[model samples]
Target: MSRFLYLDNAATTKTAPEVLEAMLPYFTEKFGNPSSVYQFAAENKTVVDEMRKIIAESLGAKSKEIYFTAGGSEADNWALKATAEAYQAKGRHIITTKIEHHAILHTAEYLERQGYEVTYLDVDEDGKVDLEELKAAIRPDTILISVMYANNEIGTVEPIREIGEIAHEHGILFHTDAVQAYGHLPINVDECYIDMLSASGHKLNGPKGIGFLYIRTGVKIRSFIHGGAQERKRRAGTENVPGIVGMGAAVKRAFDTMEERTAREKEVRDYLIRRVENEIPYCRLNGHRTDRLPNNANFSFQFIEGESLLIRLDMKGICASSGSACTSGSLDPSHVLLAIGLPHEIAHGSLRLTINEEISKEDVDYVVDSLKEIVEGLRNMSPLYEDFVKKQEKNV
Candidate 1:
């Protein structure tokens, strides 16, 4: 308990020992460019292809359909921009939720500047997009609909299959930013009718600089990167052999242990949720109760700034988040929390705890205890809490 207890797995995971072992050989002994024609590099090329096969099988995709990228942001950017450019002749309209990661949101905005029309769908109080509203938003010129499989901030699992069905019914291509959901959840591209999916290796306990985009067979997307032929000319760059091997190892282990891991994490997550709600007054859970990620538990404590709470938690040897790590430096309130109907002040106080397979019930208990002390201590000094207490008493 004296050591750092990391509860920020949603931002990035600690690379597993097995994954590091799998990558070490590639970094030293097997280091070679897959694009090289020499036999020395051919072995690395074979290893790369094997890694691709492992990731493809994990997503129920074919090896040729998987394209590796620098990380999730690159994959998401590629999915939106490349698909928009390639399909502009078919339509110039794209649709996505307001609560997507900045990669998607910024890309959508850029596409809008490029003369494409975009529909930013609104989510309900539980952070779920309405399928009916989505259906109503579609137009004859709609080319694509992009949504996250799981939210990074609040951990709400969107109804991807339903969204996919709605998109396909209208002949529009569907893309999902599955960076948060990829290794944690069981996703079969065909079963879900997903045309494109983005994922990052770091989110799944693999190396940070590597990720992949699963582009369904026959889906046309223009090249996002331009250079020597790589990724079958879909993506162009020297492959990250070590990172790819590590990702394959991580993904394989995830698949092998997913069911057990998910069950355990869910049990601990629910228990933490229950304990926090019972122990802490004037705190609200941010995401849906049941239809949320097994690893994520987000809450907004009244009358406290999230940054201050995070600092106190860090002092207690617990590493949590106010919101997405990508936006942790920003002073603005969490857009995800705001989209889910939280007021600006409540959103500013949000805390996100994302559990990993390594976390235990004992760890959750310690976190809850630490949180109780921190919230109470912070509230004792807050004039807003005093005002809130007086207002409640007056109402009573």
Candidate 2:
């Protein structure tokens, strides 16, 4: 078997060496609770504060606006629940898109069960929200609007700035789950009209288990984590000092070489797309060609089960997936693809191939070649394909 080509970066990334190096000291010699009063505690406190400033700068936000959390899920839960509690009197309603990550979608559903009205707007075939539907969904009682910055499965970038503006026009707070978009593209809170934003560290080569929520100045949100005074009381408890430190370092490196990294991923990503299309038969590329993450490449092949293909690819030392990791357990088709109007059968057969900076042209070629072989072999075994071939022969 060939060296495992890791093309599933959307799931999680391997921590960068620089990030690991930066986080080392916090685990042992520098270990101290940021909340302690002693010099040792003050040292960790100061370091985490500096990490905040660096991460804030990357998002074009002030250090005061950054609130650390367990991960993207916590940030998202906080953004939704806190915003709802803070403004429930103004409106008990919230608006969001249908293709969002389960973090936001499930949270919104939970809010619905708690008596909040949630309006789930549908996306177009291109995985874009209907601005007109958005215009219609905003009621006088609508208190918040949360949209993910990108679709995790198919890599569709949303019109978040416009959605944010629409929410603001109605005096409603706006939030975006930028876990997938934070390091992949440029983000500015003011320019995008975002009032609350959530991001995860691991998506950008930082260690997992740490993330941040950005609350715009003057935006009121109730605290989700009720505990000791920390994160200026917006978030509570001692921070993950090492993980936060690694996030800052990873963020800095990503920005320093962002353009170069994006360009390289784009080149290789496109090469893989073209190679698969030319080499494989009956393949349908999912998601927009240009308005997607530079590293994402999703496709569906007829008469081939995505899960079966995944296993075969894994055996061949090429790692990819049948869509978002969160949605893999159930046999249900991916919600993102379904929201984009794919039939359930086609959606079930979808594969997402995400490339990272470490992936090379050779890796892409290997996956494409392996995919062609797998799809062909699977189709040969598929009863549906055999029936189709038999019917075609009779017609001829």
Candidate 3:
């Protein structure tokens, strides 16, 4: 193909035109610090507050509960660190799953260094956390439970509502890193009993470097950032007026067209999954077949490295990922793939192709065909494939 076919929406999305339009005025005519008491800045402050309300409403939260941050990582860090510090008097234990994005996992690790106990719960083969195991892991002093709404790499949706109920029943706080699931999925914080939730704008066609943390009213958490009294003194720093405005526009558009977009994306996703598996030998689909995100299709092709496959796909003007964009340069196999019990070799060969509204049936077909050819060509040069073929022939 002459033009690029982007299939890595899971990592980030192209900023929507509407979102860009909404932000343009803020960068030019409306550029004013929201913290300033002057009349000129009042408009920017109003825009920030309005955007916060819109985001809060989308999550079924109060405007006061919404606090804007740099992005999902900052929100995740604040959620884990601030909550742990504030509630340490009550307890010091936290529960999280093994397959969370590094934002949550690494923050949990930081808490452990500070003498807090964290139980990293294991997931099943499909990357779904076991509710029974979660219940068993909760201790008398457990004060918080952090889990992602969905797996970023494998695209497995976790049982967030159930986990939230369990946390509330035990008088513990529940926080979910909804970076991958927020705009793509339907989320109502009240119904799920979530005390805290994190979302990034870039994941949903909004501007980068903007996101929010939803803290349910009455949740005791300290401020992570200390500076000017912004975000109602919960988060400090002059707000990114343009980014916030862009995020609000993006969130509105995403929710407005969510139903139709999800349906269409799922059709393309399923078609891609079926074609790739049917045409490619020794390729296995990762994550839950039906319960995963509507736009996600992850696979593992044997006897080849994921990086090489990704490079070949890139050569064909196809943009895909081996795993999370954050860990793209790492030599280690995906922690998420290993968490789901994939061996080192299989995990190394994993490929993640995430679709968006722009992806079409033709694009899916092209990708699958290109992938089949690439995998076959790479495997033909592999000693592993030759050995497996020889063993099979001898057995026959």
Candidate 4:
């Protein structure tokens, strides 16, 4: 396409140039198995440890706490499943919100089938988990609480520190899927009382197929994969050296630019939200107004289908998402929207735009302008909209 505007950074981001540059040497000249005995390979192992230290420092954690995994999904699985097995003697119940990513939700389901109990907590309309409800959900058998740091669809930032405190108060382990909030927000594991966290490289402009699970020192969790003594025997398979280097570089770059980048993103994001609310008729903005990610703007246009709106935006060279990219292909409405008390029809009309620092006010204006036209055209063809308009005219 001659013109392209990518507003789907939540799905994935283009690897930053600096990250790619750092990774290039590893793929060619420095290619060596970190698990080998030779000096070349031993040096690679040192680099791996250094990358781990970088990731740890970002989270205020120790290098030994970070375990490399294939991606966020794997990390999430390892955190939940392994925690369950390790603590099964102590408890068999787990707690999580209804709006978590499928990686966590599906894993919870698997745990249920395996004879474990799970409590799916409710959230407010703004997608904030009810702290009181959380307190009530904690039983003696509740071993773990897994909540996402920030939502991928609506961009609602959860009360992570508070949740972590609650989990600790109950003497239970807490884990957060920080795939969306890692590079975008500031986090410190000790201050938050967080036992474990999962984050992905691709979400922060690093290479894909790489992620890390940070287990607090002395969590006593077993390995997810069984094989060679990679990741301190916590995870199997050879380390992705280039990916690790790229992730380290990306994390540092993200933090270095975060203050300025998110400040500008918030300014533009609020502008986009304001324009959409003022200009688009019958469209409702999702998520909290100010307590959300800097770049997330989600809206639900009444009497229009989300899929059709996405196609129209795509045709206009603007990319967005209906919900989470993982479930965009599915016809079902987002569980996140439903959990927040949205009706099925309204949820079906939802659109999520996660912009980057590069998106300007002008770009947002263009997107909002395009949205007005697309929503109007789609509503014209929708029988639901036709019926509603006829009733409105009769009342007038």
Local distance difference test values of all predictions, in order: 0.93, 0.90, 0.93, 0.95
Give candidate 2's TM-score: 0.98
Off by over 4 Å in 2: 394-396
lDDT score for candidate 1 against the true structure: 0.93
Global local distance difference test of model 2: 0.90
Q: Residue-wise lDDT of candidate 4 within 1-396, one digit each (tens)?
A: 556899999999999999999999999999999999999999999999999999999999999999998899999999999999999999999999999999999999999999999999999999999999999999999999999999999999999999999999889999999999999999999999999999999999999999999999889899999988999888989999999999999999998899999999999999999999999889998998888999999999999989999999999999999999898779999999999999999999999999999999989988989999999999999999999999999999
List candidate 1 segments past 4 Å from native: none
Q: Per-residue CA lDDT of candidate 1, range 1-396, in tens?
A: 476899999999999999999999987889989899999999999988999999999988899999999999999999999999899889899999999999999999999999999999999999999999999999999999999999999999999999998988888999999999998999999888899999999998899999999999999887899997899988888899999999899999889999999999999999999999998999999888999999999999999999999999999899999999999899999999999889998899999999987888899889999899999999999999999899999999
| Candidate 3: tens digits of C-alpha lDDT, residues 1-396 | 676899999999999999999999999999999989998899899998899888988998899999999999999999999999999988899999889999988989999999999999999999999999999999988999999998999899998999999998988899999999998899999889999999999999999999999999999898899987888888998899999999999999999999999999999999999898888889899999888999999999999999999999999999999999999999999999999999999999999999998899998878888888899999999999999999999999
Provide the RMSD of all predictions against the true structure, rounded to 1 decimal. Answer: 1.0, 1.1, 0.8, 0.8
Better of 1 and 4 by lDDT: 4
Question: In candidate 2, what residue range of length 10 has the lowest lDDT sum?
Answer: 1-10
Comparing candidate 2 with candidate 3, which one achieves the higher lDDT?
Answer: 3
Which structure is stronger by TM-score: 1 or 3?
3
User: Alpha carbon lDDT of residue 142, candidate 3?
Assistant: 93
For every model shown, what is its TM-score relative to the native structure?
Answer: 0.98, 0.98, 0.99, 0.99
TM-score of 4: 0.99
lDDT of 3: 0.93
